[model samples]
Target: MEIIVVIGGPLEEGAIRRWLHQKLQQKDNQKFQFIGVDGGCLKLMSEELPIDLAIGDFDSISSGDKEILKNYAAKMIEFPSEKDFTDFEEALMWVAKSYPQQKIHVLGAFGGRVDHAISCLWTMFRPELQALIPYLSLEDEWNHISFLTPGEYVIHKLEHTKYLSFISTGSVKQLTLKQVKYPLNHQDYDFPIALISNEFIDEQMEISFESGGIIVGQTRDSWR
Candidate 1:
């Protein structure tokens, strides 16, 4: 089963209804089990969508929202607000353990708080959930980011997105890029701005790295 988790963050306020409509239009919504975290419960309920499970401390959600979610969701999983893991992390851990093969698409995982955004990115490195890397992605309004293990990979450029960035998680031995505007031979990238903001001129691009993991980010400007 594929899982879609909506976290507690600022969603394009008035766009939830239209966004949910568009999302369900292109994909088989029946195949997905919707899960809401904290304030995300409100957003999901506001769209009149069914939430299969709701997980979070509910600190960010109002009492009224909690009542609404409890009424609509099939199951409600609550944790103490002082728990060790962030709500998102806890939700992901549950997913990883219960539905290892499920693809996870996280929305509202970015924006609002900068530290929260950074923490969400760093959560990809947690030892327990590292094995779920391939199945996980964090998406916001303009960007999609995910971690990749050392291997040969192809990235098909999505329409209207002009830029791609790859940052190494550790010391990369031999990294190569093909069919890109600026191709790279076996080169080293130290997890920073050196290889950021490269344009993709082709329909599809290929990348390979001999050692170390990498985070790939595809972004487009709103004007595009």
Candidate 2:
């Protein structure tokens, strides 16, 4: 099963359809568990998308909207508005605990406030979410994000993505980039750095690192 988590970020009906279509193409005959976070449930309903589970504090939306969610959502989990973790983090924790074997694809998490975006990115590094690193991804029309541990990986370029970047959240050692426009040779970085704007020379590219976590992003300049 694939869990689709939608949050409160900029989203378009056409873009959401296009993205979901791509996901269907990749995995044929798979079931989807739609999760709506707070105000994001409003967008999902407006788009006529399914909401298997609704999660959040319900503080961002009006009572009418919450009533709509209560009627349509198969299940709902509510949290306190004054909490330590963000709604996104709470949703992730719930998903990780409940559906550990399922792949999680998050939407509407990009193009928001800089701090919110960063918080969502770092959620993967949480100790409880460590096991989900390989299975979790954040994507939108313009960008696709994934996490990588210490291992060699051959990742293919996503459709409409022109640039590939690898960013380190902590110490990254012996990192190498292969079959890319600007290749790296086992370079080491003690601090976080972004190897940005690198293009793919072919359909796929190779990357490997010995230590630390790397956030891989494939992005385009705009929605074409």
Candidate 3:
């Protein structure tokens, strides 16, 4: 299944507009199922997009908007404002159980409180979610974040994603980056490093790891 999870966490001071623009980028899009958490429901609605499922405490939405969502959403999963897991986590867990092989595109998850963004980043590290990494991509206006298991992978150039970063979640052995600005030849990383930024020199990039795994962040050239 191709799924898109929209989380309504707080965004950074200047990011909300760009984030909204990113959502607007998808017009007449009919390829994926949308899952809105909290205020995210309104986001999808504003875009004139159909919502497949809406899940959240929904304290952020007005009663009238909630009624519209209930009528428009194909399925509703409501929970109390006070819960053990975050609304996004709850939605993710449900997705994991219902569609284990899903390729998830997450938006409206970053540009928030630092900790909140970290929580979204760590979702890929979860035991239940790790297996879904290769199929998962956390996206925003400036980044395409993904987690990958040990294997050879080829990544193609995407319009907005130019800079690349590979971080070791655990201990990655013999990790290699091919045909990039800074190519790595069988490098080993026991502890995680910033690996902050690199660029693509060609249309395609080749990444591989002999053991362990990596969390890859493909970002835009926002500095330009």
Candidate 4:
């Protein structure tokens, strides 16, 4: 099964509509199950989408909206307003437990507050969800980002997205980049600004690292 978790980020209504439509067009949509986190519930409801479960503290959503969610959602899991886990984290935990083998596509996770965006990206490090790396993606209007472990991997360049950036999550050693406009070999990249912007020239690109983790951001156009 494919799980699509829509988190409640401060996204524009138009973007939300477009994203939901694009999601419905995916080949996996037939197998896609929707889970809403906080304001995400409202977005799904606005699109008349079927929500399998609603997981959040509901602090961002109004009481009326919560009532509507309780009516339409197959299952509802509510947490205290002052909880340790963010709504997105809670939703991910549920997915990790219920659908370990499923691919999770996270939307409305970016383009909000910067802190939220960073938090959403770091969700991949949750102990329970760490084993499911490469299965979770955080997508926004301009880019798609995913984490990679220490191994060689092939990433196909998305149409119209010419630039790809790799940011080391930890100290990376012996990192190699191939089939790109700017290639690197056996280099060490520190946390930030080391591998900021790199362009992909071909249809496919490959990257490998001997040790440590990295976040690969495939972006369209330019980073503003």
Q: Model 2 clash tally?
A: 0
Q: What TM-score does prediction 1 earn?
A: 0.89
lDDT of 4 by residue, 92-146 (tens): 8888889887887788877679898888777787677787787888876677888
Q: Estimate each model's TM-score.
A: 0.89, 0.94, 0.83, 0.89
Residue-level error in angstroms, candidate 4, position 139: 0.7
Cα RMSDs, all models: 2.2, 1.5, 3.5, 2.4
Residue 22's C-alpha lDDT in candidate 3?
A: 64
- Full-model lDDT, candidate 1: 0.81
Better of 1 and 2 by TM-score: 2
Give the per-residue lDDT of model 1 (tens digit) for 111-148.
Answer: 67998887877788888788789889877656778888
- Residues forming the 10-long window of minimal summed lDDT in candidate 3: 11-20
What lDDT does the true structure give each of the candidates? 0.81, 0.90, 0.80, 0.80
List, residue by residue over 104-184, the lDDT tens digit for candidate 3. 888887766888788888767777666677777888778888888889999887667778898786788888889899999
Error of 2 at 119 (Å): 0.7
